[model samples]
Target: MTDDTVRELIARSNRLGADPRNTNYAGGNTSAEGTGIDPVTGESVELLWVKGSGGDLGTLTEAGLAVLRRDRLRALAEVYPGVDREDEMVAAFDYCLHGRGGAAPSIDTAMHGLVEAAHVDHLHPDSGIALATSADGEKLTEQCFGARVVWVPWRRPGFQLGLNIAAIRRENPEAIGCILGGHGITAWGDSSAECEANSLEIIRTATEFIEANGRPEPFGPAVDRYTALPAEQRRRRAAQLAPVIRGLASTDRRQVGHFDDSDPVLDFLAHAEHPRLATLGTSCPDHFLRTKIRPLVLDTAADAPLDEVVLRLRELHFAYREDYAAYYYRHATPDSPAMRGADPAIVLVPGIGMFSFGRDKQTARVAGEFYLNAIRVMRGAEAISRYTPIDEAEKFRIEYWPLEEAKLARMPEPKPLATRIALIAGAGSGIGRAIAARLAAEGACVVIADRDAEAAARVAGELGSTDVAVPVTVDVTDPATVRAAVDATVLAFGGIDLVVNNAGLSISKPLLDTTEDDWDRQHSVTARGSFLVSREVARAMIAQDFGGDIVYIVSKNAVFAGPSNLAHSAAKADQAHQVRLLATELGTYGIRVNGVNPDGVVRGSGLPAGGWRAQRAAVYGVEEQDLGAFYSQRTLLKRQVLPDHVADAVFVLTAGALSRTTGLHVPVDSGVAAAFLR
Candidate 1:
């Protein structure tokens, strides 16, 4: 191709973002100038232009391009000491470009100078990087490009990497491109179009490899591993992470994803104690910029020193920072800014993949998405062969570079949910208690109201000085009690933020055996109580100028009417419709309303006097023991429901976790309701 054609290709490449996923900012570099043997002289021309470190590829200009003498760079590398290698390399290039007037040469100048081709393009493209860092990376590479590509294991970038590539090219002169294991790739061609085409081909081939092998295994069989872990162990682990996460977040309140100890995958991850297993790092180099190089391994058996773990993690962070400082001093010129202090971009707990933290939500979200994608690619690479990671020093240099650190710092501030408040009724026990606990865990100050004063106090005691939870007693069916509850909650917590209208009643009786008095009693608590409490809470919330979330704990009977539950079914059906009206009327005020319809919560606190055993015996007119076999055989899962199951549904609704859901009833009956609907 002609020089004009190559220049056009360079401009097009510069216009493209580093990561298509990261359109807001660019993360790569490029150059158009070429270097070769000058026809007039026996020596090579100082015609190479490399992109300066920190310049965005997406909007690169002539000023961003760094012109350098390829011959001078090679000479300096050969004579410099190992520790002074980067320094001498930079100095030599600076001297060569003295009066040329362009940006400083990129840190990768030494490596790029060694390439024998006329045009070379390098990128940390997500697709190719994902494959390169995966387990069977070499095999995956061969499958993609056949004999056109060469795979080189990870080595420190700059001198060692350049030397390795040179040796590989010498050994395989026919190779069109090179894949750096656990890093990125280099595509060289006779023309810029050919080189860019080769790069695109490599990415497409790697993407296909991932498409064929990267999906997570079906969760059915894997769930057993997560489910096997003890609940207490899971709780403790979550609790320990909570305070640390809160501190990292710099917020007193934050909601965390569910901690499912019963998940087979989680259980397996928790028990993975083998030393060999513990050494696994992230799948890609960019992941290190989020989750750090190593994970925080927890030894649950012995008295694991949490303080020691934190101290060690901090030490590792500082060490990473110091190494980054050394790397900058070695590679950067005096004009370059000082390296940022090394705080981990991501943290990995032994069992957890990685945790990305930022000052705000958007930063955390971007980091998290990148980290997860890297994990998937890493796992896919592992499927092909044992995947390794980039060297610690190299990653430290990239992660702590002043330019990258500035990118993270420049991220926009997070949106605030600070004015929101949540109130959980019937929170002294069962699902109410669980919802209250979850909302409080997420940083919401919760006022827990229950008929039983002692139960409210007990729950309040458990939560302690976090003051995120306050307890009060109220009779939901009484207007005075409902108003007083709202007044007290608003007074203490500032305003009514969210109202979990979960206080209700249930009674099971054959249709013909049902009494008018029994029906009235059930309606009083279920329908009337909901209306009373909701009306008062809504008025208070509207006056406070802050809209709210209201969730009613209805029943599956509202949809598939249950046998021998005429009164309870009728009451719940009415409550479900009431929630919809509230949603319609409150939408303008920014209030949300939803419902959870649970079938039979076996171990729930509100279960009738005889429990499931008695209820089944009564239904079939048989002894309790005989009813067990009948119930177990009839149900799909054969396991009774736990209070926590229903509580989880309420928590998700009241915590404002589901953004699009409102005036909708979510069934928490584990397919029972599905079967009935079908």
Candidate 2:
């Protein structure tokens, strides 16, 4: 394919995947094929460009699209033993790579290649899946769109499905698309635009049929009444259940669950037929790998006390695991591996919204997205008639398939702090950004909250992994914004495990020169902001019944006096005292509170940028070039401090290096006698 053609194909894939109604995150694939010069052969040949297995279509790039020799990929189907050839097929695809660049093509590459079209789009649109996965899916499909689309029965995706699609095309040469029973839809055309239009046309046909001929009338009151409840009430219920769910979902392997909940979740969970709909298994067979067959449904009401709620949830988790074990034993084949413990990927609670579980924040969020899309599709199916999807036997087959497991096995091992979520205030720059980066590197997913939205986004983008960081704009001093940030953290990462109170400001003026506004502004951020974040996060951690860490970034001025720094010094002193008091009070709940006090950092610290160090240097009558030496001479170590030095102390305390210690101040200064802790 020409460079322009490749770019257009990738752009079309991104556009199709961008709509959640059309495709869930990482749930679909696309391909484009044409004649191109082979890198190795140096001759013209047919090349098939397909989306890689793990890449997200919405963010598809030229590099993410794997290029393969079309003849080589198709030739593997001829000699391969038809049964369980997934591994061999994958090897053949990898073997045909044009060059050393690009990842392995998606497992569905064979199916795309057999279509004989210039461009092909395979998407799991909710509307199409809703109609196709139903009990009478084939009948309904024919009734809705006559002969324009063909219906293919459930077949495991591999060489067999590719052959099946080819046979269908041979019989129905005029059909524009094929809807895979209990899976998704596939469309092909001479160009990317034509393929896009054909897929949309099929979805529109199904949607119209469901609305006109299948829309349910006078929905029942039991679930309908709950869905009608106030939105705030639903959100509050979800928040209350979030920490308990996280605690119950945690495993002995030290995996912590992340949660996503909202009004849509509440409505789905509270629906009259929710119990039946939620347990009927996934709307599509491919989802069996991510969501399993069914979700765990809890019946606890929102009015229950925290202690009682925790006890009940523990009982439910135990029962769910036992049942899962029984199911595994009943269906185990001789080839089955050692049985893994039952961990629910999705949790549905009455009154509260549904919560999804994963080994890390991004995984949980992705699972949540899939389930939410499932709910939307299932709702459409139910509106038409009872939503009957694939049976349990087929679900188990896909769940244990080695081909699907290989995708997960290819991933590298996680970091020591993997799956742990941390919230860092003022992380847009300076010491705060350093701390955030260090934590993310250690495997903890960091929430970059800052007053500057653009800076936070830039820092988040700079991080190497999409799963490691999320940026949120937050003014720590505002109570509403502070509370929203706390909720965002819980929703994004299940519950808070670490909090870095790093946001601070200063007014470098003497007592008489400092105005009332200066004092309030300094205290608002340094003292009051710390209190709010500490209190809110502590409440969430305590609810989770899991121990947490909170570290305050205090200044050396909080311990020793500095003239012309009255407002900042007083505010820092207040928070330093507050940390000790909070440590004493929250220790009973297993929450550790500590502080890190740094003297001076000549570069890349908030002190220099905000002119606090310059003002002190001016008081000493020292030039800018001599500031580092002036501060270094005051310490015994005779070396200037850096932001990274402060960040190291923070990690030591927060990352369990000081698990049994709390309420003490760690000094990051080279060594200042006047600022030394007593």
Candidate 3:
């Protein structure tokens, strides 16, 4: 019946972690006691494999587990320098490593190892924490599960806390687990399946108790005026405020943002006691870590004129940062991790929505999710009894814990374009797709914009989830759709920092054969499209006051005077000059404008094959497949240009390396001497 292996441990962890009903993301740790062969001694040594620092149990893998000799881990209890020096003990776990290259041990590692059972789970299930943090938590514990689960008082997580849980088990022989005061729940059993079952039982029983016996309207009745706005109104309002909020958040370090307006959130915000509860702040350490001490709750009404509301929100933002700094100064020890930031991570605006900020998109999104968990905990606690969380001092102790800081220090360095938001037009295919993929690889959150909705969605899906890329349908010729695309980008992320004007079409015709309609059609999609999208995105960037980049995918035909390409040549020429003009005009704002000219990119792009391949091939007296060869032969290097080649040039122009060189056109045409920008 007992399985002393990490495989079962990881399976149990993933099952508990994957369900939002069980625990928040990366908010719990699971462990198993097993015997493994020591590499040097060739002896079976008892080992404790636990979830590693800064990793999610749902995504747990063998490499993500910290393997330590159980005896060595337990030995630390003898020399434990008490609660005051518990942070020092985190360093001691490194010495207990059973093998090389396992993940770094987390602060909760000792708790898992010190427990008497072979399998243990430490989770932040909202239902369990609700009872754990209620005003009369110990009394409620007796009422709900009675002798099955014991109650342990609030103790900051470390060596001492681990000792406290172990002591509870000794005192309460009938208890399956204990609820840590103002924290989460811990469960244990002889096997992984038993441990998992016990943990779920606690969560399920608590949920049922809350539903059957708790009072109605735990948050009090909803305030009519504070209820959620209509769907369209909500999205529109969020889009308008996102830029202003993003600008404020980017003050110390540029942050990407996520907005949530789910029913649970709206229900909480509409309640009478929302402000009081939020002001008390999040109780769980994991909650405050992501949400900060509390949110910046906006008092402005949803129906108020937006411009005036923005001003009020800005004032609140300034006050929030000031109050945050005061909170830091109140409890910060000299060694406390130098005030991670003073800006509010969670912003609450009643009737509108919640806006969460972080160093990147996924982080921002996760922060919002954690706050939702906090909301759930609060609701349950209020239903059963008076809701209470850990005091602010305790929150500060865990927030600035040295062990947590060290874990942060071990994270991989960010990619070059981290925090930059990009909107790439024509991203559905060809050079645009290449540019989108390249930018995403460098850590940019991209917005895929194209006339073809399905194509744009396909490309966006390939890039990644909404955190990495979002698709927006846009007809470059239509001013309305162009502006909407910019708004969609702001709504999806916070704002725009990079714009690629790659949406274009080509039509090749001799002077006598070319029609007026052909000339107008090509120019409308290419020249006008670029101008409209750039104007809207530039407005957003200017409002953010953050310098940005705009790159146009021009063609070598603009300079080379290629045959049978009159309309295409004229449009590209117009686009090439516009880049220079915009660069000079927008230079004061530090918005860099540049162009990348490529010679007949006939391989991957739909543009080449869309309609002009055969015409251009006939013009050069070559077959459709041989057209690329003909274009390459004319170049000095006789090298065919690829979509990725043009993509590289676009990246070089915008990726900060060429910051000082604006209005400069970079050529990706395999050494086209005549096509060089003069």
Candidate 4:
């Protein structure tokens, strides 16, 4: 029966969580009581199973449940350490575990246990918080829900609030739920079915109430001046602003960014009152956890000139940091956790929309989504009554809570390339593809750029996710396509940091046999391609004002004199020289340009499939399969170089090891006496 109850609870939790109308992502808890056999006592015991700390309701499993003896959980009140000492109760909960326990219990555990019901659900539905945060919340709750739903004044979730809600539930037997003031909602029932029904009733009722009683334009009507620009114009503007925003937002540490111009976001931003409400910050703990205390609202119009917007952004970013530092000092006590960062997680541009930043793409994207949730709450709150949020000091307390600090401490350390974004220009296959995978493993977001769009997309699919990597087609020789790829990268992430210019073709022929077309094609793909990619990406890197890396995969033949490799070798030499030139020019901007010279990258190389291998084999008088061995035998190391070896050199160059090293060429060849740079 306990197993069955856990299953039913999971199903119900999924249903409630699947609907955004019921709860925001990972912002709710559900629990159920059932009979379990006690091994020690050899008797039937009632157990409580509740969603544990940091567990998401939509995907909750048996492992996500925190099981405890129901009797023991209820008895916690007898030893209740009072409101001021409520945090101690969380520690005491470990002693009440039914057995070895499941997951760590969340702060809302006692609220689920103390209520005299078989089932309970605590959620953060926007509609519920809308009513909860209204200026006249209690009156509004009474009017919206009648006698069936009770209203509790604002109290941060903890042992004391649990006890208060339990008392309310006991006194009002007719009530099915409570609108938790300045928070969300809690519903309880004797059965799972009854609990779900009650939860749905609260959500549906609140939503219907807001729709019926709220003003037509809750945001006080959209200002035509702040309305969304045309799609193409908005995208161009967003791409222009994303890198600068990412660079500023990463003032403390590096951060990935998300650009949002969804209908809801645009609608909210277009309203005249958005700036006033955005400054007040969010009310819910979950919302504020991701959004920070408040967003940095861009003071300029969306369609303003690019130069004006960029200048204002710098001013605003500086002020935001100063204000944040002041906020920390004003409320931080000796016991408070150290300041995390002053950079705003959410940035609002009146006509543009929102830009949210985090340590990773998903986190950044989710932060934007949470701010949208804040928008929903604000819209509803204003239509019926004034928007009221928690006091600023209280927000500080929650933001820097000791427990929150501990949670962050438990998270795994970020990968070496975690916040770095890379552009692998020829990542469809071979050396380029290997570098993409290597960087992805180290936690870099990558853009797979190749002339073969399908091949680029295929490699991107194999690498990771849309958030981790994206694909774009670009002919290295074409300036238009190169610009498009670079712009796509900025739009995909916030900007570019790591770049590998590895696109090249080989035409194995003696200088006498080499045709003009062969020379032009080889140079076009290798020399011209590298130059074009570097030039365009350098612009974005300069605009971001953040130092970056560019690596060219030049071949050993670039320096070593080799027969039947005229066009290929000359183009390779051109790339090698470009590295030195760019490194010299871009050094002032903190951009490091380097080169990797590899010998005979035979395994997993596109050259073999592109007819270069057959030509090389014919010239060497060796069978097609023996070409690898022939190349290896001539090397001092007697080992044929592979794509992975080149990738390793690339990683070392950009992964902070060679931070100060630029205009240098590191050889990835096993060993080549003549090829070694003098």
CA deviation > 4 Å runs, candidate 1: 1-10, 14-28, 35-46, 74-87, 98-101, 134-140, 210-221, 224-246, 249-279, 283-286, 295-344, 347-355, 358-366, 390-678
1 against 3, candidate with superior lDDT = 3
Task: Please write out the lDDT profile of model 2 over residues 198-239, one tens digit for every residue.
Answer: 888887888788888865531233553344335566566666
Q: Can you write out model 3's per-residue Cα lDDT over 187-218, one digit (the tens) per residue? A: 99988899999999999998999999789999
Judged by whole-model lDDT over C-alpha atoms, candidate 1 comes out at 0.61
Error of 2 at 596 (Å): 1.8
Candidate 3, superposed: residue stretches over 4 Å from native:
1-4, 608-610
Show the lowest summed lDDT stretch of 10 residues, model 4.
Answer: 601-610
lDDT, each prediction: 0.61, 0.80, 0.89, 0.91
Cα deviation of 122, candidate 3, in Å: 0.4
Worst 10 residues of 1 by lDDT: 252-261
Task: Give the Å shift of residue 322 in candidate 1.
Answer: 17
Residues 102-160 of candidate 4 have per-residue lDDT tens digits of 99998899999999999999999999999999999999999999999999988888898
Candidates 3 and 4 compared: the better one by lDDT is 4
Each prediction's TM-score versus the true structure: 0.44, 0.86, 0.96, 0.97
Off by over 4 Å in 4: 39-42, 608-610
